[model samples]
Target: MEFRRPGPTPTPWSYWLIRLLFKFVLKIFYGTIVVENTHLIPEDGFPCIVCANHSNSLTDALLLVTSIPSKKRKMLRLTAKSTQFGKKTFTSWLIENAGTVPIQRKRDFEGQEVDNTEVMHHLMKALEVGDAVCLFPEGFSRYHPTIAPFKTGVARLVSDVLSKNRSHSDFKISILTCSITYMHRQHFRSDVLVTFHEPMVFTPKDNPELLKPVDYNVIRDLTAQMHQQISHGTLDSPSWGLVRTSKLAARIYAPLGTRMSLGDHVRVVRTFLDAFKTVRKKRDQSLVQQEDDQHNIDPSFISELETDLKAYQDQLEKCGIKDDRIRREILPRRTIIYRMILRLTWASFLLIISMPGLLLSLPVYVVTFYAVRNFKKTGPVFDTYDEIAQYKLIYGLISGVAVWVIGVLATLPFVLITSLLIPALMWMTLRWIEDAVSSFRSFTALGRLFLIGKDTLKEMYDQRKELHGRIMDMAIALDLPANPEEYFAQAGGKQKGRVQGLWESKAKYFSIRRRRKRDWNETLRLYDKVDYPDDDSEI
Candidate 1:
């Protein structure tokens, strides 16, 4: 591939083609991808900067590059650490072609963007030309779950851009905050939920505030907003266990029969976190005004409602059942049968169309997978968990390309007649196979739920209902709707569990199958009343 840099103007055709390729490649890696509020991107020739949390390294950039519509690819520019592109290797070449501009992570002094003027210039130039510059304000990706403190560079860079573009009255640049959540960060073929928050705009007028010669108050304020917004995007607790438990709790609190995946579960939490704030704000306003209307909600009401929801989630965690099993335990028998029949029908069609491609790709993928397992022994140099997935994808991509070339060479003489035909056929079929395999796994899991016996299912369902009844009692006291669906309807902003889930990737599943196969019965027993008495005092 030819190397190219995105300039002040739009990139050439080759740059966008590789970006398109990236779109397809990433989709293959992540089986279930949910991108929300993408329509918020305005392409009206206004300067834009996408400020997102940095966590997953190159995969983060790849996701942002492909998340928007293909038409917007020409205007997208991604930020990379200078070290990533210093060498002229194939990966570096790919980054250059993908419209990356490097920022120096280290400055002579901490908390200063005083150095790296050229890097600043490139970012400013992109914004000046009505292009969208993507940046991770945190400066570097942290391997941990928490969002790192944003470096002062983003605020400084935006302040500088506003000052430089003062002459254009019609020009306005917007910083879009994107929050990306992965169900299993290091795990391959995990689910991803990319949510785009509203944009923050800066006109020429804001420049004077930033241009103050002495105090950096304006910069500090901007950085604070960035920190808050990015933090909203990240899911963090003291440890991964809390994060995992919180994730499962969110799914349980979601609407029944939705079968929400961990990624979607996180999105629900993100959406409700904002909604919870809104409800509180409204409640506070009512309290201060002492509204005469009988329907007016008291602030204490929402407070209790929040507390009850927490208790409900805590009790479910104490029950030790996953969201999928919970759904199966309570769903109507007819609905369960319908889903099984539908999944079986779909699986048969997938098998017929996808078997050949699966055969073609399996051998190369197997060899590459084992090869990269050795590299994992060195462990991750960075704190990132995505190293394993990255290597697998990189090596798998090479194997794919090599095999395709071999296929072309072998099809010689007839190659011209079938070049486009063969490649297109293989790509579609291979993708179908991947999708089919994932769905089959999910189907099998659902089937096993039925096999767990009516006695066990009833026991689990009774436990869930007992906890849910307590939540309803609290809801009734708060003078709010008791049903989960009804409460969601009244919230009136985002309804979670909107998207149905997809199956997990087989290659990734097999890698950690044992851990996932942990005895749920034993887990439940550990949480049983025999182990620890509940508030009811039963053992």
Candidate 2:
């Protein structure tokens, strides 16, 4: 049975209550979300479908639905697998009340086929009422940056909606394109960027009841168009490690007063790959052809890049740090030691104060580490790193509740105060550790970069300077932006940090880091205000 509310729309009270709660939950754990062109999002009281690339698991769907403008959230309906709605619980109740519709998309148990006619009926009903539907045309989450083959479900939905609105003199249905990417998906508190591309509009054909001969072709063409638009917003990486290495080298070579914001880091890495491709296409046209056919950027480029960065990568490893810290802090600074001391001092103080909470959460921490460390589910479809992040969150929340319950039991008379303190302290403790580690790691590396009299470290910096100088020369020759300060001043960036860094002879890969303060000369505003088109100009 399909789950539907008593009426056309979900109760506004229930909808916003859970929507805000879940949205807050994701924000607390998943990290910062940056949305581009939010004004382009279609308004409520219009029939529309929001199509997006699926990268992270359930989080992907949540992000698309939650991150839209608040007023339109109530009108949004997510098309979910039918199986999930069968169970009656808080999750199901919440989803159904959030205006979700179940689609029996394929074969079910006992080899029986699902009845799509019912699904289509419910969807058509939703469209008649001007509710916007959100669907992932791709059935599941992709493990990488590349978009998978798109399913034609969205096209069918658009056609069916058009058919139902045949009686109206003016028919309008819009498909909005949304593309999102995760900078560090496997890490908690990482960043996400969501871009809402322009919408595709459809008008009724000449005949209301009969279908147009070209409609099928139009649907197929539209599917292809959506795929292309969504892919453009995706973060394509031939080699994440190589990309990170290039940023490190970029920092060494970039002009003075150069600082890149997080967005700027993304722009730089993407620009590098794009530039690399354009350059390599001259040397080998066939490799470029394969890349154009949806193969990742030529693997040969990453191989050559790794070879070029070998020495610098090794030196960074020895310092027990990453290239990001040097690029983010040291390179931009006329002075470094003073900032390092203050950061170190602050981190130590935080650690001392957070111990009470840390000690209480120790048991949960041990379990989290054990579960994450022993995770050995390697298979063709497995993504280990992202899965690890998922587990940390699941375990952390459950254990947190357990700790609070224990606190309640221990302090019966003062249960309310004690219980609050236990969870509060534990949350602060975990958050503190995550932050302190980044600062202290950089502090240790600063010592090696400046204070430690190590020959290898000195040689590494020297090599870095020379390579960076060459990169600057190349950028100038190509007429590219070679200075981060100027480039970021113009508003551009990319994600940069420790990727699969160089082979560390002395230790495991150091933790990844990004500067909290972005190096932007000017704020990059997200959108220009726009007035909605009038009835005649809707198209």
lDDT of 2 by residue, 337-455 (tens): 77688779977987898889877878777876787677734533334443554556556555656777877898999987986777667656655665576567557666555654445
- Overall lDDT per candidate, in order of appearance: 0.59, 0.60
**TM match of model 1 to true structure:** 0.69
Q: After superposition, how far is residue 345 of candidate 2 from its true place, in Å?
A: 4.4
Local error of candidate 2 at 520, Å?
13
Compute each candidate's TM-score over C-alphas: 0.69, 0.72
How would you encode candidate 1's per-residue C-alpha lDDT over 1-539 as one tens digit per residue?
A: 22122334746676777677767666666645667778788573567888888777787877887787755435578877776786866668777777788776654246865457887787787777677888888877755655777777777877787666566555577888888886565444455778788888877665567643525877888888978876776564333433443433344454532233333456455443433344555566775334324434444544554555455445444544344465553556666677777777776797788667766677567867786677756755344344555565566776777777777788898888566765566666655554465455546555656566567667667756664554345334435444655555344222222232234334344221111211111111112111211222210
Clashes of 1: 0
Please give the lDDT score for candidate 1: 0.59
User: What lDDT does model 2 reach?
Assistant: 0.60
List per-candidate RMSD values in Å. 9.8, 11.0
